[model samples]
Target: MSGTAQATTAATGTGGLARTWSSFHRAITTNLAILPTIASIVIFVAMIVFGEIAYGRIVQVSTLSNLLINNAHLIVLAVGLTFVILTGGIDLSVGSIVAISSLIGVKLAQAGWPPALAILAMVLIGSVFGLISGILIQRFDVQPFIATLATMFLGRGLASLLSTQPERLPEESGVLWFATKWKVIDGPKVNDLIVTPGLLLAIVVVLIALFVLHRTRTGRTVYAIGGSEGSARLMGLPVDRTKLYVYIVSGTLAGVAAVIYTARLGTAQNITGIGWELDAIAATVIGGTLLTGGFGYVLGSVIGALVLGLMTVLITRDGSIPPEMTTIITGGILLVFVLLQRAVTRARH
Candidate 1:
């Protein structure tokens, strides 16, 4: 009943209320931070359900298996882009890297070179180009966009100089083994669960990327850089090395994608992978990887790639939706996700 006692009780009550509100606010913001990623997942599930109901065979084992087999290269590319994007950098050269790598890979095979040697050369070439880009950005103070753009042109030009026409792998080429398919389940009436070695390779790449981005110290360092390169440097997180590593990973994976793609088609052309860079970037963004960097998942990127593939599949099955409309639809979806990202970011702030 005393005045001082009453005042003290009221002050304590106010402090408790403030603390509760602060905790509540934190919880909401944290949820909002991951909302975009969650939205992507929901959208993907919704698409599958809608497709299956509207178009027969959408959920068939065969269709699903083929989806993975066909887009395996894109999945790998997305994984690589995830790494680079996580570090708040862009790699414009991945598509061109695919063009050049596949060109060399198929040509080498056609030349009667050992498959192992050709494959090794293909991967190493990517890493080399990645290193060049990293050096230009980190050491020479070039912007990532400009540096990567230059490398992109360089890669495409090199491929064009080598061959303008399509290159085909000989039937006896050992690299064809990558395209070999294995049936994991014998479903009835062409519904068997089929998987190709290329798909397996893509799965391996995803696994390795997940490990590197989540389990290792380097992974933590990558997140730190994306969060803030200045802070990462202040914390002694090897920002320079990690930036280089991400680009190298992206380039190397592009090469791997080329291998998978070339094996699948047994052919490569100078124009191969045209516009694929946009697809990879769109997949990453749709997967909820912040364009500004700092938060994303490799698995999310995989799902994003699948969603894009499924869109194309649906278009083909529906026959009413023009095939060319696929890009317009994809662009619209990407715009929505990007806006979603912006909204989530604003909510966090």
Candidate 2:
């Protein structure tokens, strides 16, 4: 072949390879929203390796159980946020809802109400707040961020106004009983590896979230809206109602998180969920949810929470590391994941 023809052929071949690689990358990233969950497992493995090298017994069943128990609330909160993100919206008020719900639920139970009633009341309060945000954004043309931010303040103020101090729920309260472990597996060593009802609740919520996002028509509509609100609307996809429902679902989940947290702690406080919103957002994002809106996975959020929880455990196990270091590490991971998301998004263009 002539030199010019050879050069052209080489360029064409290179272009084909580049295009293939780009397609593969996009496919993997989009479907691998579940990758974060796997990454969390890998991180745990790495932590175990590091712990074995640094501090023996870091992999003990007691340590793992404690880690899971402590972070169950985070997992639940993350799952709720994932639903909101998948619908191409944000819910900044979940932490506040958590606090408010915790306060109301505990107070009602203390005031001679049945535990079920208190739980219902708490979830109702959360749903109401969510509805307000949804209405403001979907009907009034307000931004989702601004609407949810307003609700965040509203929830926090309500929680604080409800009580300036922590209210301790009685240990004997049936609500607290939900926090106890049921000993499903009964491991031979180190506390039996029992599973707390709170953890099980979180798992159940994750499964439900997965079902809604993947199987339901409403869920598909959510993704369509997120993919393009204008197109969804033009196509008559019930955009406004779908957006409203997304926020409501998020709010209800937040309330459920409050019940889990309150049951586990046996205490409800105005300041109970300070900064928890950031953690939930981070978990959702790190789990591969797009911040620009649309695309997410419940299992990914669970993994993100687990990754964070494991990081905390690792830091605590290492005597040389300060507890505050965990926050810095988490922030770093979130930043990296966000940048990765942006890169993937740009590549699709």
Candidate 3:
């Protein structure tokens, strides 16, 4: 009887220890996935609270919806950027691509082409540009930064050549309907939940991006390439093709962003997305994408974009905070995140 009791006690102790270890492991996993998002959420809440205190009704649903609608294009841009960064690559030409596509689409619309055709042309052009960058980087062993930077200048010049002045989108274009507001019933009759098609589209893209990254073999290859290119090549993982695909994806998304922007602003210019590449990169970094590549999350990028959009709104709402402070704060956050990523990488080594 004594022996049996001892044996039972030992088993129970071992089981308890195992359970505790499992719990700890889960906690660590959860933290790794959520730390970046948590930071964005915390900042978002802080911004909302500050906005409420600084500007009356700034925390209202209408105000929040407006902010999201205004920045939906940036959200898409950031998502595309997140994909490129995940593969240890950068796309410097996306902003210029956006400008070019927007200008081209608007010009085509002005020339009496159907809105659908113009939109398709814009997206295709963007993908073509991305393909060029990918080919250059993969075929020539060019650094991603330098290759994309060259494309950036080319895209910017193309956009400028297309039009010397801002082109207004046709008021009659059906595509503009995407910017139309929809009211989801909330509580009382007039206090409805407001939503924009642009917001819905952004959400959908983020969801699809997450699914692709986490569920597909091609996506896994991207992570693998980012983690170790030499190993990926030895494994016969289609490294060059995969890298090219990522750029194409980024460019295609940028073109879509141009359509969204045209619908929102009803105007396009060569300078429309002049500095947007920086914004997208900043968003990706803030969302926990390692600058050196390999690990990243699309949803994190979405949250990062939201965090930035909210910061802009908050700064605008709070007259006391200088507009320039927004850039400084974004830069600071990026620096901190990069440092943290470096530390984590070094610790692993």
Candidate 4:
């Protein structure tokens, strides 16, 4: 009887071990299902660890505050681009829109216009440009790349026609109010636990985008279109309307980013946002948003912007590394993420 009891116990232990192994395997498979997002998160955390080890001061409250303040506009731009990208469309004109809108708004403010009105004009300008692109693409059947490229040139040219030099905002301008910070803590190590209106605005934009993308029928239609436009159309989705809205969102957000950036800097120039659209696209892609469309998160894009901002901080803190290396590092990280995305896509197929 004792011998029989010992054999039963051993059999139970074996069964438990098999169950544990099976659970582990299932967990790994489930993680791999969203490999790009997981990879992005891992890389972001690794970068933070490396930064903390190298610059000890990187984890300070002031550093954290500055990270958000500096990248707030970029976060907004990336969020906007995520929508466009998720719909299998691209907007190359966002950078140009930033330049033109900022220039126009600043010029108007300098001309004694109400700050609020100027700001509205900036957004309107961007939306109009987007509308033009949408009409060209949807109505005339022009490719997105070509249509946005033409609009990009037009925006840049118009901005340059206004002035190549920087236009400074007036000292009493209300637009600069966006840069005001409210302190949340006081300490000698990092005194400013602060929040700016610009940062708050970015956060609000992100939250709105998250809600629209996940909680609304229009959002699902956007994803369906991205998955396959032909299929989406067959399902009676308003593909054309949704597509137009995406560009308009992208453009309007570019304008919003310009306002935030201009407020922070107190100056707007024709060259204010050169190549920024590329950074926006990079941030969206790095955040685990597939280039092929159909899957992404607005929050992930925000994290991606933070990652890029953190890289700059790390590079700056390391005095030995040339500042020029920042761009190279960014490109390398982007390429690595792209390769990882491709691998995951292949595995799924």
Candidate 5:
């Protein structure tokens, strides 16, 4: 009787220990999953603190305002990217698509097209490009990378055929108003807060993206696809249609970004968006979206774009770091985040 009691006690203790360990492990992985996003927030706040200490006027209303203005287009691009990345797909044609849209919008406006009509055309062009990419990827067996790359080439080629040189929008065109500044807060000593319609558009995009990603069934399917396309198919989700939707969203927003950028600069060139696709990808990765897909936040991408914008402001203020160093810094930051993502993925598995 004593031996049996002792055996039973030993088994109960072992079982309790195993359960405790399992619970602890679950807790750790769950926290780890959220760590990248929290890290991005912390890093952004840290940069602000460092900037304020190291550079005067870093937090001034004017400087802060300019940060958003300068990166408004990038924020839009990153949000679009978040959608595709969340579906475990990529769109390398975004930069090229921007070039095509900007060129078309400007040409139409110059040719006496109504601003609203021209803007609609620009958006439609983006959607067409996105639709092409989606069809190639879904209807056919083309890999996302190859399909987007081919579409990227097609966009650039079409833009080149339109005009190899820069086309300037007329100053009197109604489209230019998107870049017109509106004072928000009249601050002390020329530090007033100002914003543009372009910035407002970007904010609206972010809000919409938030709603779609968190509130809709399509959004859930997007995540499911990213988590595992095979499993998503097995579960009877609308995998094909959802994948198409994400690409279309990405392309359409790329058009919107072109509108924002071209209006601000008053010039559209075939080369206008060269290398911009890489920048958007960097922003997305730095924002805590996994390059492998399935985990990310649109708001996080907003913060990530702001981080890059702030870095640019600091570099300019310092007057020591070359403007080109911005890309190098971006590359470094992207790499760090990618490694962190790998660690998280391992833990999750």
Candidate 6:
């Protein structure tokens, strides 16, 4: 048609697109549980772009593979923490559990025990610790923070007693074999896409968590307890049982994380999991799991793990920044999200 008619049509199309974008933004922002996750995705993308600008090869296939490989254990830990945080509780002992469990498994392997039995024992140790914490909190009315903190010290102390030095896995051990085996894919553009069993294990854990958190009746009860434990009890829900189960799950996953980490490194030590609890908590919070409880997504926590991994990659690429800055940056991000959560909570009321 005429030039003026064409310009008018283009303007109308632009206006329609703008309205659609606005509607989508409003829908996401109105849900406080979802807003932080969306923000995390944005921040992750920005970090990736920044990394590419600084390092020139940050977008390679290997870079992507490393992101998943390096952070798989952390992802598993964060998923577990999400469960506890969803129930309006926290587990400070996860990092210590990781250390102790890994030490136990590695020590057993070094002492010539069967790999399978050693692995089982390591996991059981974590479960037993978690069960103790759960009993203290649910049966004896101990605060979650205090109970888990006590376990944290106990775990670390036990790990140190086992070995002050690193314990390396035997070269011929099946555990080491599982850790090193690669699931290699041949891509058209990339010669080889390498994935580790640890990555696959992390994926499996996430899937199971997704089902438990979103599909099960117990999961709903966990949320209800987080929202209001008194209301949940009044409604005939098994509040104490569900709360105890959440801690058990957290502890079990910490054991799982320890296994993956030790396998990847082929060694274990008393200091193996120092500060990891904080990292898991940060990932959970960044992924949109409210510290106040009752809201979160498993996939969001995975994304949060990826975000942290990306931050590390970016900081490493920029060699001028001190390695210690990573914690500072993470702390800052956590603070901002915590404030955002507070604001959203206030607005909801």
When summed lDDT is taken over every stretch of 10 residues in candidate 6, the lowest stretch is 183-192
Q: How many backbone clashes are present in model 1?
A: 0
- Top candidate on TM-score is 4
lDDT tens digits, residues 116-143, model 2? Answer: 8998898898899989999998899898
> Could you give candidate 3's per-residue lDDT for residues 1-349 as a string of tens digits?
6999999999999999999999987886655534555676677778778778878676567776777788889889998998899889999998999999999998898888998899899899889999999999899989999999999999999888888899998899866777888987574534456777777987888888888989998889989998899999999999889999999999999998988888888899989898899999998888888777788888778778888888887778678889999999999988877777776666556
Model 4, 121-192: lDDT tens digits are 988888898888888888898998999999999999999999989899999998999899889888585556
Clashes of 4: 0
Backbone clashes for every candidate come to 0, 0, 0, 0, 0, 0
lDDT of each: 0.91, 0.83, 0.85, 0.88, 0.91, 0.89
lDDT of 6 by residue, 78-143 (tens): 998999999999999999999999998988898899988988887788888889889999999999
For candidate 6, give the lDDT: 0.89
Q: Candidate 1: where is the Cα deviation over 4 Å?
A: 1-28
lDDT score for residue 222 of model 3: 88
Off by over 4 Å in 2: 1-44, 58-61
Question: Across residues 50-168, which tens digit of lDDT does each residue of candidate 5 receive?
Answer: 88998888878898889999999999999999999988899999999999999999999999999999888888899999999999999997999999999999999999999999899
Question: Which residue pairs collide, candidate 3?
Answer: none
Model 6 deviation from native, Cα RMSD in Å: 2.7
RMSD to true structure for each model, in Å: 5.9, 5.6, 4.2, 2.2, 6.2, 2.7
Q: Relative to the unseen true structure, what is the C-alpha lDDT of residue 115 in candidate 4, on a scale of 0 to 100?
A: 87
